[model samples]
Structure formats: structure tokens, C-alpha cells
Target: MSGPLVSIIIPFYNDGYVNQAVASALAQTYPHIEVIVVDDGSTANQHLLDPYRSRIHYIGKANGGTASALNYGIRMATGEYIAWLSSDDIFYPHKVAGQLGHMLSRGALISSTDFDLIGAHGELLKPQLAVKFASAADFLRALHTFCPINGCTVMMHRSVIGRIGWFDESLRYTQDYDYWLRVILSGIDFHFVNSPLTAYRWHDKSGTSRYLDQVNAEFGIVHGRYVHGLNGLIARIGG
Candidate 1:
């Protein structure tokens, strides 16, 4: 089979640290990537992205949320495969190439890899393992316990996006988790790459980490929709 074209979608808002993220995607060893950076109504540090204007496809939109920005990128993308990267994260040089190779070989609809957690100073803090879900049921069962896939580490076929639909724009946090649940419920095949392919920065200033309660509430909504709700409970206890 021919190599697939991967669209890397990044959503940012007033992130002074966006340069590293953009540089990493631009530096990917995979030559078939199209980098799309969505500016989520960022007012401060707009100049931070000026250096990458020629290297990336930049889009400016109202600050609805990361989900809104990502949905916009998806609509504008023309790639056979799509991947998401956070503005605060950086991918290893060979991340795209390695993940793309695995997805093509396995014919995986959606795939993700392990990643390293880095501190604000760029020191390695911890290594996160990529959670593997054997089936849709397995994924639903683990939804409330932990996230089955890391959003930034995911690389999925275009068909998967069409089947699962777009990210939930209503979700300000845990949008990825909500999307993953929908994908799992649709019964798409998923896989995990054993190697660490990206660095997820953890700092006090990061949005998700700073507003953990909101994140938790959003996660609860997803779990309630899929597990604790009428349909979810029926799926679990009935079966």
C-alpha cells in the first residue's frame, strides 16, 4: 500500500510554549505530514506563532475550546489519516513515521503510543503507558477508571473520524475522553505502539492540570453517558 498522508492538528491559546510543539511536528521524520495549527482566539503571545507561518497551515477562530478548534482543523484537512498534538507537547522526531508504519501494517483504525511526562524545566518526570483496549466492551469498562488512549499520541484513519463523528464541542475538558468513548462504542479497531513517541508536558500553568475539577466533571459526563447511564448500565449488567 502507498504511504498515507497524515494531518497533524494542534490547537493553541495564548501559549508562549507553542514554538517547541510546532518545531517538533515540522521536524517529524515523516515527509508526508501536513501540519495545521489552529489558534483558539489567542490574544496574548500571538507573535509566538509568527516564526512558523511558512511551515504550518494556520487558522484563527473564536475561542470556543480546543474541541472547536480541532473540529475546524478536521473540516479543513485533506489527509488520509489524522493525528492530534497539544500545543504544550512535543513529539519525538520519528513519532509520525513509527506510528504510521504500525497503523499501516496492522490496518488499525485508531492507534496511540506511550509518552513521557516532562516538567516545566524539561526534565523527564514519568513515563505513561499506552492503554490497550481489546474490544469495545473493554474500552467502555475502562472508561471511568482511566483513559484508554492519550489524545496527543493518537493517529487514526480518516474513516474512523467519519464513522465516529467530530469531537464534542460542548465539552471544554475531557473532550478527548468523550470522543474516545464514542469511537469505542462504534466498534472501531484500536492498537497501541509500545514505544514512547511523544512528551506530554505537565506544569501548573497548563489548562487541563490547572482546572482539574472541570476536567473531572467532564469525565463524569462521559462516564455517565456510556457506563452509568441507562444504556451503559444495561450494556454492562445485562450482558
Candidate 2:
């Protein structure tokens, strides 16, 4: 059977590591895949994407932020499913194939896999984070404590945007977590694949490290909305 087309959207800003990021998307074992790279006003790194000009669909936009860039790319994408890949992270070759299979087998609209935390030079960090949720209460409990889904490790049906809309443009950080919260609250059930399908890069210069304060501040704002609305939400999340 033919698989649905999965658009791997990479919102490119920092030019330094985009090559590796794009390369991984192109290497996906899944055949029905399209790679879309959105250049978010990175003048210095624009040239780095020149080599892949003939391969991936590229979009050039002003420096709004990661959220805006991803929204733009999604708007321009023509695929049944959408997957976000960070410009600094690496998606394993089986990432798309594995997640896509999981979503299909489970009849799920969204799926996310476990990923490894790696250093700037690609050295593995200790203790890979794994996801397991037997019930909605379990998932909500995990979310109430910390984000269980990694943005790059997540794949959702494009139809979800019609329900939850785009990322919150106002947020400069933690938008992924915010988006996931919206997905969960919108009565959407997500499947978690235990396979490690991506590597999340952590470094001193990364956005999470450089803007740690802003990330924390935005995270507080994102989850706080749901915390107040958690009274009867567990049932909707279960299915």
C-alpha cells in the first residue's frame, strides 16, 4: 500500500548546521516525503542552502521567528502529514517511516517518537528520554510536569491545522510546547512511538540555552492556560 505524503518542514535560521539538518530529511527511508526549508531571514547562512537548491523546496521569508517561519512553510506545503525538523537537529533515516507507520497502524492523527539529546558536535548526552502513556491521565500528568513530545520528533496530519490553527506568533520560545498543548486540548488523541527517531542538539549557543529565561517565561505562559482548564479534560484526551 502507498503511504501518505509527509512534508518534512525545516525552518532554517542559523546557517551553520542547516546542511546536516536538510541532509537528514533527504535521507528518509520513506519514499512519499517532501522536504521544505524556510529561510527565516538568515543573510549570513543563506549561501549554505545553495547546494540543495535543486533538491528541496525552499521558501525565503523575513525574520519573524521560528513560529512564523513554520506557519509560512506549512501554508506553502502540499502534503497529507507535516513534520517539523529543527535546523540544528538530526532526524534518523527511519524517523519518517517509523512515525508514519505508527500513525497508520493506530489510526492516530498525531505521533511522536523518542529522541536523543546530543552535544553541539553530535556527541550523545546521557539518558535518552522515552515516552509511554497508557491513559489520558498519564499523558496529562506527564505534560503537567514536562513536555513529553519533542517538536522535531513529532508528526501530525495536516488536517490538524484546520482544527488548532497555526503556532502562536507572539511566543518567541516554547511555541512547540504551546502547540502540543493545543493539540491535546482540541480532543485530539496522539500516539507515542518508543523508537528514537531524532537527535536534539544542545549547546551553549542553542536557542534553548541562549534564551533560557525567555523559554522558561513562555513555557509558564503556555501550560498555565491548560492547568486552569484541566477540570474535565481527561476524558476528551483519552480518545
Candidate 3:
């Protein structure tokens, strides 16, 4: 099969470190890739993105949260496959080539690869599995146990978005987790590449770390939306 067009969507809010992330996408070994950077009403260091303006498709909108930014990016995407990258994360050179090759070869709707955790100083912390689920049921079973999927490492077919709809704009956190639940429950096939293809950065100011309580609350909301009322509540509590 011919290679597919890959769309890399990034949502950022005043993240000065976004250059590395944008560079990662632009440097993908794969040639047919489009990089979309959505700035979520960030006023701090807006010039941080000026260097990449000519290389990437940039959008600036009011701060409506990551989900809203992502949804906007999705609507504007014209590729056969869509992937997301957090503003602080970095994709390895072959991330797009490897994940796209695997997804096309396997005819899978959703695919992800392992990634390395990077510290603020750009040191590798550890490697992590990119693929968290082998099937729909497995994903649902592990939903509350742990978040198996990583947003930045995921690459999925455009049809998956068509069927599952866009990310939940109402969620402040766990939006990707919520989207994964919807994808799996909708019976889409999931696949994985075991190689570490990206760098997931963990910093003091990162969204996941800065908003733990909000993240927990959003997690509960996702669980309730997918796992039914009583069972989902139990799972969230048990988790």
C-alpha cells in the first residue's frame, strides 16, 4: 500500500518548550506529514513559536482547554491518520514512519508506540510501553486500573475520529483517556509498536502535574461516561 498522509496535532498553552516538540514533528523521517500547532490563548512568550511559523500550520484561539484545542485541530486535519503531541513532548525521528507503517500494514484503526520519559534537563528517565490495549475488551477492563494509552504516542486512522467523534471539550483533564474509552467501546481495533518512538517530558509546570485534583475529577467523569453509572463509580473509587 502507498504511504498515508500523517497529521501531527499539538496543543499548547504558554509552553515555551514547544519548540522541541514542533521540531520533532517537523523532523519526522516520514515525508508526507503536516504539523498543526494549536495555541490555546497563550500570551506568555508568544514569540517562542515565531521560529516555526513558516514550517508548521499554526492556529491561535481562546483558552478553551486542551480538548477544545485538539478538537479544533481534528476538524482542520486533512490527513489519512492523526497523531497528537503535547507541547513538551518530543517524537523520535522515526516515530511517524514506524507507527504509520505498522498501522497501515496491520490495517488497524488505532495504533501507538512505546516512548521514553524525559526529565526537565532532557535526560531520559525510563522507557514506557506505547500500546496499552490489545483489544476493545482489554482496554475497558484496564480503564480504571491504569491509563494504558499515551496521548502523544498515539496514531490513529481518520475513520476512528469519524466514528468516535471528537475529544470531549467539557473535560479539563483525562480528555485523551476519555477519547480512548470511546474508541475502544465503539469496537475499533487497537495496535502497538513496542519501540520507544517519542519522548514524554515530565516537568513541574506541565498540565498533568499541575492539576492533579482536576485530573482526578476528569478521570471520574470519563469513567462514568463509559463504564455505566454504578460500576464506573466503583472502578474510579477502586482505582
Note each model's CA RMSD in angstroms.
Answer: 2.7, 2.1, 3.9
Model 3 CA lDDT for position 82: 91
Query: Count of backbone clashes for each model?
Result: 0, 0, 2
lDDT of 3 by residue, 128-160 (tens): 735455554555577765577788889988888
**Rank list by lDDT:** 2, 1, 3
Model 1 global lDDT (CA atoms, 0 to 1): 0.85
lDDT of 1 by residue, 17-131 (tens): 7888999999998898899999999998878888889989999999999999999999889899999999989999999999999988888888879898898977899876556
Give the TM-score of each candidate. Answer: 0.91, 0.93, 0.90
The C-alpha stretches of model 2 lying farther than 4 A from their native spots are 131-135, 235-239
Model 3: CA > 4 A from native: 129-139, 229-239
> Tens digits of per-residue lDDT for model 2 on 149-233?
8889889999899999999999898788888888877778877888889999988878888887788878888778888555457
